[model samples]
Target: MNKKILGLVVSPGEAEKKVNTLIDMIPCALKEVSQNTEEWQVQTIVDSLTGSAESINEIFQKINAHTKKNAWDVTIGITDLPIFHEGKVVNADINEKNDVILISLPSLGWKLKKNVIKQLIIKMALTISESDNDSNNKRSPSFINIFPRNYKSVRLKIKETDSFHTRFILGSKIKGYMRILTGMTFINNPLNMLQTLSGVLAIGFTTGAFCMAFTTMWQLSYLFNGWRLLLASVSSILGMLAWITVSHNLWEVPSKKNRKKFRKLYNLTTLSTLMSSILIFYFILFLLFLLLSVTLLPPSFLGQTLGIKEGIGFTRYLDMHGLLLL
Candidate 1:
């Protein structure tokens, strides 16, 4: 018997872009799945069918009836509306006997990356067809035991969830690359790009302020003792920590108290990245200054500007504090 897969887009005209993407990617995905079975003939048709259904079960039933009437062996329905199961957001849901799979596009996040969404849809397709057995076997036996008998029904929550890590190796380099590509693509959208630019500017401003404080302390060291510079450095770091903590709390979800730990981790990572970036920026600036000074400035001019004493050598002056300016 020939296998037929029907892809449907149950969304309004506003979501036609997503529908177009699904139409283009689903065939390639099914082809990948059917590599071992040459007898299977896969064909796809896409159309806009907006439904007023709210719950996953209702949406599934609606799609099931439609698929049955159309004589589609397997139906994959994509919708812009949010879907929920057990009071939690779900990316996709499936019914085995009904041979129908419903994908809730909104659950994939607001910043849509075509490749990520396509992969997710493909994953759902494979899951529904039971062709994900090889991948499933890689997971822990305890996890595999939780699936319903014969994989009759499955629900997935793709965004802002810890479940994906449990099912797949979360640290894969390929996965990292995919995420980076997705982020790059997502930022192509005007709103997402603006948000990214805002984040960069925020980080840049904070790092610049911290670097300026360090530079100020370094200048003060020329007049005062080194201990004063050390104290200032400690204070600057404390201020950065305070700012991170405050900003994190302000942006965090108030209802998720457990996120406090994750927020700390995020803050620590951000702090390290910020400090390292500032240090690198300072080093680049110092290099440029030194190059210009060596190529353009006269020795006497350098000596005077660098505060070289009558007997102190230019090299010695550079060694003492010039490199420290970086």
Candidate 2:
């Protein structure tokens, strides 16, 4: 079979680098699809179209005219402008004729923009070239829809063909990390950053609290010999973990009834656990302060403030030798 050459038109000269990158990646993306389906050949001819069109329809019409004039099998237009379908922003739009695909860079957003565009462009190319019309491939509502918010749903179902599975798998593997790094760095949207930071802080606080409780138990071991202190510390940490799990489930679970019930229980348990941990931590600190006062404070001050005789040494109060025994 002869290679089917596709023309890629880029308007608004500023997007040349991004468009060129997509053009370079398309061949690699289509490699599996082409090999599996009777040696279908695909090539891209990149062109820079000057001037701008007022609407997405105008952009399509202009590109369509060029594709018809050049007798190209397919044409894709890459533009920086935002494109909309039925009032909602779309990352890319494919005409039913399958001869033209228009990509709106702004709709892909700043985070993972290039990778997403590459995936979308490749999907479009393979989709247009697929020969099996009987295969029930549900078209995504929008190009952004192709990149589902849930990572598990990132699979692109193109005619249920095994070769196309590679495309979806490759795209899904990197998407999760890309989104995380993008949220941290490139996008820098305040809400996203705050949400991510809050999650980190929640986990950090839980771990820190557990460690502090254990440290408190160890320190208190000098005063108490029984397993009661150890049991209490372990119980407190377990309580904290339970509260965290409930709260996390409350936030993640979609069922309204379960969420409502969990929300109330989470709030009560979280408050109780938090208060207990704070009190325990503060008691530990107070003990440390008392130990410091006894070990370091002058006998004169101790006699005046603690009402102790001047002859008594600080070690007499804390029994430093006993503490060292542990």
Off by over 4 Å in 1: 1-3, 22-25, 36-53, 131-326
Per residue, candidate 2 scores C-alpha lDDT tens digits across 142-171 of: 344555563221323233121122111113
Q: Which structure among the candidates has the greatest TM-score? A: 2
RMSD of 1: 11.1
Candidate 2 lDDT (Cα, whole model)?
0.48
C-alpha positional error of residue 197 in candidate 2 after TM-score superposition, expressed in Å: 33
Per-candidate Cα lDDT values, in order, are: 0.46, 0.48
- Ten contiguous residues minimizing lDDT sum, candidate 1: 142-151
Worst 10 residues of 2 by lDDT: 161-170
